[model samples]
Target: MSLDAAPGIIAVTLVTVATVAIGTWGLRFSRTTSDFFVASRTVHPRLNASAIGGEYLSAASFLGIAGLVLTFGAEMLWYPIGWTAGYLVLLVLVAAPLRRSGAYTLPDFAEARLGSRAIRLLCSLLVVAIGWLYLMPQFQGAGITLHAVAGAPTWTGPLIVGAVVLVNVMSGGMRSITFVQAFQYWLKLTALLLPAAVLLIVWAGEGRPRPDVDAAWSLPLADGGGIGLYTTYSLILATFLGTMGLPHVVVRFYTNPDGRAARQTTLTVLALLGVFYLIPPVYGALGRVHTAELASADALVLELPRLMLPGPLGDVLTGLVVAGAFAAFLSTSSGLTIALAGVLSQDLVAKLPQHRLSGVAAFRLASVVAVAIPCIAAVAVPHVSIARAVGLAFAVAASTFCPLLLLGIWWRRLTDVGAAAGLMIGFVGSGGAVVWTLSGGSEPPLLDALLAQPAAWSVPLAFAAMVLGSLCTPRRVPAHTSRLLVRLHTPESVPLDRG
Candidate 1:
């Protein structure tokens, strides 16, 4: 399944140009710190939802899910389902409360609720860590997409994406990122939808012969038996709980005008994501019939168009998919960079030299650092399957921030000491699994399964540790805990004062 460089190059170029164009347009609306950071909290629900959908649908959704479904069949459907359901969890449990808290970043929420600079500092570090973990896969996926399409060198793709993201982020910060991401969502959806529609027509013309599926591939949770069940449930937990914890995702909630808008935004996001996710599995099912011999499953979406209709028509379809794929890299990376840069500037960069630096200047510097670290890692580290790398990030988030957010919003007894201890436990436990995965080693089955999917154990451990630690240090609970809980849980229509 070979492709011409001309179409891929043209598609990538167009997407890059459009991203810069939209970002530059947004620069007109971005003049102050609030504008850059939260678009002055004036974003409408539908627009905010589009931007969230754009940023949230990273390489994993754009390329990884279809590939996994193609490789693993029915069981892998859990991934996309889990990802979409995660927002459902967010809508019901977190959206309005998080917005009502009026914090720009996750650490902002932690410090505001707990009133402890120590917990804020810890939260800042984890945000940067998780942002980098998540960004690395987008970079890796970019390299894969470019190499599959234009036959570019592996390193070139990450470098290109990093540079593009830095430029977009440094141009106007979050305001620019919001516009760029919103545009990309429609771009990506159209890219996948058009190709799928065309392919379905071609398949129908050929009488739509059923693709052969073995019993193992046809049956969900039937492959690895007990281990498979554990892995599926573990994946479900990670994706569902992890959505609220992702820095790129959570930061967007702060861009809404009020708690009511925040809930509206989340509902729209669920609808948008549901629509976008439906297309990937189509590619996966079609892949079984065409391009089944391709070496990498991730390239199934990219290669299928060309293989099915190998001519000018096929080239056009492949080019559209490539554009969408590049959009995925840029949009998701830009969102992650903005969130990471916000934390870095506020927590680390601004703290230097007696805190004299201006907000925008500090943010620009942070943007570079945020994009640079992961860009370097993307090239240096050996590539894992794109979806698995992302899942590891989700595991880290699930273990650490999931408990923090759920408890901080719902329970008034959560002390700073408890939150900190839980974070460290999650970090060390999941962090060990990450190290093991990256280090490359043969291992016993039980240990291997445990390390490979750490969310099952690590998430529970973090929650338990927080509960126990809080119970032991009940006196250390913040004095403002009750007030904050009321503000978080109460509806905006209530007559009580929030701040």
Candidate 2:
């Protein structure tokens, strides 16, 4: 509430203008269909890593993590740890294989792996479902950030963000967004890093008071005995396994020039995220020392600067943080939108027999549908916590695609029927959990915890279904599985002649 409209409005305008300008520069490189979808597969490792960091560090990192740290204590540190470590999982198991698959979208990879249109359709639905799931909190977070920024109607943030995303994404797709996202990442880092350094100095000056709370808060694990441990492990499972399954995250691999670049990109992302995450804990700690309990904890990042400094200096820092917060929403939403649009355009729009739409035209149309649906949902259901929603999205991805990708890339016996069975089971289990949480369902504490963090059970069940389903349908494995595996594993430089 102490946040002022002056800094908020200025921050919004500045970030928006800079994003559009960078996107415009990227448009020239987006003329081809390949450019629109995957940046012509020419992005460099460091540059692509920055873009990945930009888009990957969503409102969850910018706002939600600080709030959680401020309110819940050290147990919430798992969010950042699992999220970053998920990349290491990606690096070892998935980064190279996914790039070598030569697929533009997750469904394309599924279809290529299984040799079944049915499997493709299932992956497509899951992509849209997961994309929309991830996007809802971003849109909602935009509303929250903007509301704190300038007392704007809660709806304005979503609408404004939706329009900006549509224009940037619909204009030049991935090619256009590469520059925008990379710029936003550094901007976001500066915004947080500088403010955090100043705030820490101020806290030191004030004797660095400890947070006044229960002993349970500083414990690394949940306090609910067995049930608490379950929730903690489930959250860990979702975030750790979920990175490889996210469509936006996966599609970035496709943009790499080859498997090697993809691996390099993941490594760089780890370092960048490590540096960026350090600052949020600073704000959370400073909040403990300087500010009282906040009505909107998610706004802690924005409020801390203004409250702690309490002058022109604080207002200036507040403006910088605001810009970074807005950048978080825009960058993440754009990446999700691009990934969703690519899936929709490829699996739905391009296949429409009634319309003779060009690939670019179809992609443009898909982009509209992608951003519009979640924008509406964000506005309609505006009360969910940004961090929790993203975590759920991670859970769904872990349950569904994590099994498929891990199995498909490594296990050759994975039949189309098996993949389809596993995807459906994962979909239903994780989707059910999502529905229960979103619907505000509650029960005895244990049941609520189980459903709330369903990844522990849902993920294992999905893997079991795939393994058993494949073992049972041994003869149903695709005939080309051997050749495809060779291609997936072979170095691009040592190509086998197709002839």
Candidate 3:
């Protein structure tokens, strides 16, 4: 069934215009740099939760997961479950402390906790790397969605979303984006859910045909299964820990009023994500019954509407799905760009004495730099799977910032030398894997295993390196560990000066 481009294009264009308008209106309330950066640290938990859900549920959650379910069967459900469950880990372990640290970026947190500019610099590089890796998939998904629905050139989608995201992010920073994302989260959920319900009913009315469960559901780690298992485990590790390390996700914590509020935000995010995740698997399972083509799996969510319900209803629904797919791209990319821009502004562009840039000017400049690089990469290398590229981003996040944040916040013995050593090991290990994969080099079995699932080993290796490095140079441990710990865990109600 071919999608007519006219209606879908109109619907997506309208939605994009409305989203930007609303974001621009949101800027009226954003008067200060603090407002732009953290909404003056006053965003309510419910709204923040929705924004988090919006930002977290990127192309992977919206389109890729359903596609995976269509192509790979029940095992693919683990991706969504792991993605949502990672929030539980974040809530239990990191959220509040991270919020209480009062850092704008991950590097800010690192420098605050470790008291090391060098460590902050290292963390900055990782933040940009992870953000770019994650951003590529969002752009790619945009291109795919536009090509599917609008019949436009594939690059059009990424270009459109990239422009919209830059406009929204540069206009108001976190202040405008928080509201925009919260709204988009509901828009995306409705776009997917309404069509899902209609399609399910249509499928039921036409006489329910069971999916080819036997062919797709078989599971055993043999007959070329070892590679799948290895990749799966690596993916699991990446998503499990990557949430904590993502600069965009971490930056959201800073928007909370306090550590406790950050924890509460995470809990709400978990519930929102859990509810949203249930819808995608339905699309996947239904796609299995309706459209079995492997290449069509990526278009499963967008195509299901037309397949089940033909004529005007299907076109409208398809248009809505197209708009939501664009939302997935725009919201996620906006958050990622914001995070990347913040780091680049602080670490790279801010170094010039004459520049003295601060607030919106700094953010806008960084946004341009942040968006341009990934935009080019998305266009230049459009063949990578959205989910796989996103997973690589997560792997990089897991290998680098995960160790730094975990140890920086909790381990008093963490030293600058140790942190630097860990960052170097993780960067080399995960970066090498990514480069090798991109290079298309013939890798040995063990090397391939290491490259694909480096987190399982690389993370441990980083931790060990950091610990050993620290022990060898105990003098490098910050002298203010106790004071910093006290500040991090203390309730926000307590005034620091009074204490």
Candidate 4:
């Protein structure tokens, strides 16, 4: 079944134009750096929740997760479950306090909590790396969707998405992005849900044949698996804890009016994501019954829409699916780009003595830098699995920022020496594993285990290393730890007075 490029392209083009128009209209209200960065810290809970849901459900959620379920069965459902539940953990453990701390980025939190410029710089580098890695799949997924729906060349999708993201992010920054993402979330949910209902009903009418539970559905990790259980656990650890450390995700918490609103926003996101996720696995399950010889398991979601609903109905549904896939691409890329641009503007461009680039100049330059590297990487390394690529990003996040944020916020005993040690250990351990995996070296049994699931061990090693290192070098602990804690937890209603 081939897609009719004209109607599908027209539909996708309309959706893209509408989204950009909405975002552009938002720019009139974004007059300050604060507005651009964090929506002036006044975003209501419901809108903020939708924006969070939009940003969180990227290409991985839209395409990769459903594809994974189709390819790997019950085990793959854990990815979405782990991902959605991570926000619950964030709400219970970190959200309120993180917002109350009033830090703009993870590095901002690091410097405030640990009082180490060196640690902050290291954290910044990791943020760029993780953000770039995460961005690649979004671009790639966009390319795939365009190719599937419009019969356009593969590059068309990424190019279109990359351009749209650059315009939205550069023009209005976070404020514009929040509105765009919130709107896109609804579009995405509707795109997936509507087709799913139609397809399911059609499927029921055609006689509800059970999926091959024994053939594909019943396979285990031991049977020609991509990675083993150890690796699976590591991935779970990364996705589960990585949300807390992601610069984009963490930055969203700061957009809330207060700590309580931040917590509420997270809860709303969980419900939104829960509703969106339920439909994907249904597509995956149905794909097993309707389609044969799926070229790429990652293409399962897109292909299912085309297979189940052929002709113009299928084309329209496919077009909506394409638009949602692009939404996944645009929303995720925009959020990451904004986070990256903020870091670059503050760290790289603003530091020059004679020339200070702030506001739109800094943002535009940062957007170019933010989008270019990942775009290049996406073009260069096109073969990596989207889900696994996302997992690597999570591993990096879990390894580096996860330790720093948890320790910075919770442990007053954390010292610069300890923080530095943990960062180095995490970088070397997780970074080396990633390098080994990518370099095509003969991975040892133990090394394979380590590389595949570094988070389980690496995270603990980082924490242990930090603690032991701090204990041995207590002098490096900031003397103002208690004062910092007080400031971090204190409500905004109370004013700080320095006499």
Best of the candidates, lDDT: 2
Per residue, candidate 2 scores C-alpha lDDT tens digits across 120-171 of: 9999999999999999999988899888878888899999999999999988
TM-score of each: 0.98, 0.98, 0.95, 0.94
Residues 294-319 of candidate 4 have per-residue lDDT tens digits of: 66677777778678777878877877
* Candidate 4 segments whose C-alpha is farther than 4 A from its true place: 1-3, 215-227, 439-446, 493-499
Lowest summed-lDDT stretch of 10 residues in model 2?
A: 490-499
Which of the predicted structures, 2 or 3, would earn the higher lDDT when compared with the native?
A: 2
How much lDDT does each candidate structure score? 0.90, 0.91, 0.83, 0.81
**Candidate 3 TM-score, C-alpha based:** 0.95
Roughly what TM-score does model 4 have, to 2 decimal places?
A: 0.94
* Candidate 1: tens digits of C-alpha lDDT, residues 217-261: 767662567877787788888888888899999999999988889
Backbone clashes, each candidate: 0, 0, 0, 0
Between candidates 1 and 4, name the one with more favorable TM-score: 1
lDDT of 3 by residue, 272-309 (tens): 99889999989988887876454446778888887777
Question: Which stretches of candidate 3 lie above 4 Å from their native place?
Answer: 1-3, 215-228, 292-296, 439-449, 494-499
